[model samples]
Target: MKAISYARYGGPEVLALGEVRDPKVGPDSVLVKVRAAAVNPVDWKAREGHLDGLFESAFPVVPGWDVSGVVVQPGVAVSEFDVGDEVIGYVREDFLSRGTFAEYVAAPLRTLARKPGNLSYEEAAGLPLVGLTAYQVLSKVLQVKRGETVLVHAAAGGVGSMAVQLAAHLGARVIGTASEHNHDFVRGLGGEPVTYGEGLGERVRGLAPEGVDAVFDTVGGDTLRVSANLVAPEGRLVSIADVDVVTYGGRYYFVRPDPEDLRRLSELAEAGVLRVHVSETFPLHRAADAHRLSQEGRTRGKIVVVVDWDAGAEGGSQGV
Candidate 1:
């Protein structure tokens, strides 16, 4: 299959577009014909070897985790989906190879969920990782409740935007931090947008004088450190951005594949309560450009890589 891969960890220049062998489908996995794939910061992070000690890495790695497409063939033990069923998956496995950047991914069932009826392939592709991150952090880690106020750092980001919507859908008042340009965008997603940088807590307090019930940090560094002071003593704090969160009595989170969690996001999308914004789309061969854009750390929504819009069952063959 045609795919983007790197022989060694380095810069975007190291990525090469070429044909690669198909991924092996385990008994519980399915081979998917990828219509689109979404780029996340982790893609570039892994490409630069930033996650070397974390994910088991190998050379000639394909770098992507979010895929939206159709199931072409299901493994022997798989019954949740069949041929031609539309699906979205956060296809992160135990290691770093056979990613969603390719034309096909042998995705395990746990990572695959039925695509939301209201979302396109690109939109669905954008949801799995970021959407699941916010869902898991709020629903599982923080346990946000109705009428509570939740603060989301970097609210305009891929994950932060979804976090804002998810928190609001849960009936919590959302306060999101973004640049002035994104204030309306954040508000459109049901968050009260606050400007970032110094005095962030003071600005947030100007809206919620009682202090927020929970803090969700999507941007690390000072934003996270400063937001810590704004959370009430009994409030929960969760972060996917910083390991230092643990030092401040917060839970450091990593998103895991959960069909149930993803299903909830799908339901929310279908119900018009959750939406994914795609900032840009690149052809599969231009994956490096997508990585570069994500590396800039300025994107308001998601960046997607389009494989074959009209992909077919025969095209699903990946040398398996």
Candidate 2:
């Protein structure tokens, strides 16, 4: 099937729109005919060999994790879904290769969840990775409770935006850091906005003078370090962006797929407690453009690649 793949780890330039063999369905897998897939920073980072230490990728890797599609076939062991079921999944496998940036992906049941009936395929595609990251950070790592003040850095971003909405829905007083341009956007998501940069702590403190109950950092490095000073005495802190957060006694998380958590996100979406924003979309063949936009680090929401393959037509098999 036609897909975007990289022969070796490198930049977006290394990505090519081509055809590769369809992924084989495994026991406990569901073969999905992808309608849309979202781009995450990890996708590009993996492409650049930054994640090579973690995942020994095979060459000619299709790069993506977030997917929304219809099930074409379900493996023998799978019972949760059937053919023609609409689903969204964080399809990160133990290794790289069989990915969501194609017309088909064999998604393990562990990573799959029913897509919210209220959401469009693009919106559903955008949710799995970032939504899980935000939800897990708040509910699991931070344990943010009602009436607490939570400060999220880069809160207008993909994960951060979801964190803002989830934190607000949890009844936490949400404070989000973003550029001046995104302050209104953050406010609409129920967060009080603070511009991020030098004196970020002071700005956040200006709103909650006693320090916030928790800090969620999606932009790491200096932003993570600076926010460390703003955590209240009883506060918890977590960073999905920084490894150095450990130095500050904060937990750093790499997202793991949990079917239950994914289902909860879908529930939240269906209930209007969580919403996904797809700021832009590219056709599947234009995946490199999606990666380049994500690399810029300024997109306020998710970027999705729409796979417009026709089921009745012959799938492309041009690039071997």
Candidate 3:
């Protein structure tokens, strides 16, 4: 099958499209014929060798983590799904080496959930990584409560978009940071958007006189440190960006993906309480372009890569 692969880690130019052997499925695994895959900071980070400490890789590596696809084959021990079930999931989290950048990827059954019927393949592909990140930070680490005020940085980006929507759905008053152009988009998602640069503290404080109940930092650096001061007593602060150490009421967070959290996010999407925003979609051959756009950090939402083995295909890949 044709897929995106990298011979070495460097710039986006290192990524190339070519034919590769399909992966083999293990006994508790399901072999998915990937229809769409989502690009995250982690993908580019791994590609550029920025995550060498975490995802040490050899040559000829496929570099994507989130996918929406259809089950083409089910391993002997996998009773949870059949050969034609549509699913979306993170391929590997315990180790960041194996990912979902190809036409086929094998993943454990527990890591996947049924794709929402209301969403297209691109939208489903966009949800897994960022959605799980947002869900875990708000529901598990922070324990965000209704009537609380939560502050989210990079409010117009992938995780930020999901965070703002989820926080609002939970009945929490959300204060998010994005550029002036995204203020309307954030507000439409039920968040009070503020410009991140300049006096961010004063702006957020003006919105919430009492102070924010929790802080979710998707853009670290000064934003994380500054958010520490905005947190109310006993407030929780979580960062997926991993840029700086964050302390809020003596609490700090580094986000990780969990199968249970993915399941919960799937439930939320199925129930119509969560919505995914996909800003762009590219063919597998254009993986480098997708990486470049994500690296710019200016995209409004997620970027997806669609795999089209049959050039003239009329519809989305089978069940997905």
Candidate 4:
């Protein structure tokens, strides 16, 4: 299979496209014919060895976690999905040795979920990691409720976009930060857009007037620190940007992917309650370019890599 990988930790230039062997499936895993995959910050972070301690540092690592694919064959013990069901999932973050940036990947049944009927392969591929992260931060970690106000930093980002929609669907007024260009886009997604720059705190204050109930910071640095003061008493502040900071409450780092969380997101998306935004698409071989664009910090939403778009599939082009 044609794939992109790096033999060492470095810049995008280190990535090379070439052929690699297919992955072997374990008894608890399913071998997926990868149709589409999504690139997250973790893809670049892992390529640079930023997560060396959490995940093994193996040379020639294929860097990607989000997958939207079709099940080609299920392991002997697997019963959650059949051989032809379309599925999407967050591949093994527990071990970075294997990844979804290829023609095929073996994913555990626990991380896999049925793709939302309303979403396309490219769209579903973009949902797993970022969607799960947003769901966990807002639903699990923050526990946002109706009639409250929540502030989401980097509101136009991959995770931020989903976070804004999820928070709004849960009945919270969402204040999201993006540049002037994405203001309308954020508004369309049910958020009051605030430009993230100097005087961010003031802008958020002006929007809410009353204090913010929770602050979900996907962009670390001052966004986290300054937003801390804006939180209501006993409010949660979850930061996925991996910044070290002092706060009265909230969790840091992208938490582990949870099955129940993915299930809820699936139902929400299927029911038209949750929305996914996919801003760009690249071929699987261009995984390097996908990483470059993501690291540039300008994409409005998730970036996806299409491994194969088979035209013979049921509804349309099922990429697997």
**In order, what lDDT does every prediction score?**
0.90, 0.90, 0.83, 0.83
TM-score of each: 0.95, 0.96, 0.93, 0.93
Itemize residue pairs with steric clashes in candidate 4.
Answer: none
Summing lDDT over every window of 10 consecutive residues in candidate 1, give the lowest-scoring window. Answer: 311-320
Error of 4 at 188 (Å): 0.9
The positional error of residue 114 in candidate 4, measured at the CA in angstroms, is 0.8
Query: How many residue pairs clash in model 1?
Result: 0
> The CA-based lDDT of model 4 is what?
0.83
What shift in Å separates residue 125 of candidate 3 from its native position after superposition? 0.2
RMSD of each: 3.5, 2.2, 3.9, 4.0
Give model 2's TM-score versus the native structure. Answer: 0.96
Question: What is candidate 4's lDDT per residue for 1-320, written digit by digit as tens?
Answer: 66677788888878776667778888988999888999898889888889888777666787788998899999989888899998889986566767888888888887888888889999999888888888888887789999989898888989889999999999999999999999999998899999998998888889876679888888887777788888878677878884564454567856566677787888998998877788899876567778999989988988998875464311221111
Ten residues in sequence with the least summed lDDT for candidate 4: 311-320
Q: What is the lDDT of residue 207 in candidate 3?
A: 93
| Model 3 TM-score, 2 decimals | 0.93
- Per-residue lDDT of candidate 3, residues 28-134 (tens digit): 88999899999999888888788788655856887888999999999989898899999998776554445787888988876788888888989999999889888
Q: List the residue pairs that clash in candidate 2.
A: none
Q: Rank the candidates by TM-score, best first.
A: 2, 1, 4, 3
Error of 3 at 206 (Å): 0.7
Candidate 2 RMSD computed on C-alpha atoms after optimal superposition onto the true structure? 2.2
**Which residue pairs in candidate 3 collide?**
none
**Best by TM-score, which number?**
2
| Rank list by lDDT | 2, 1, 4, 3
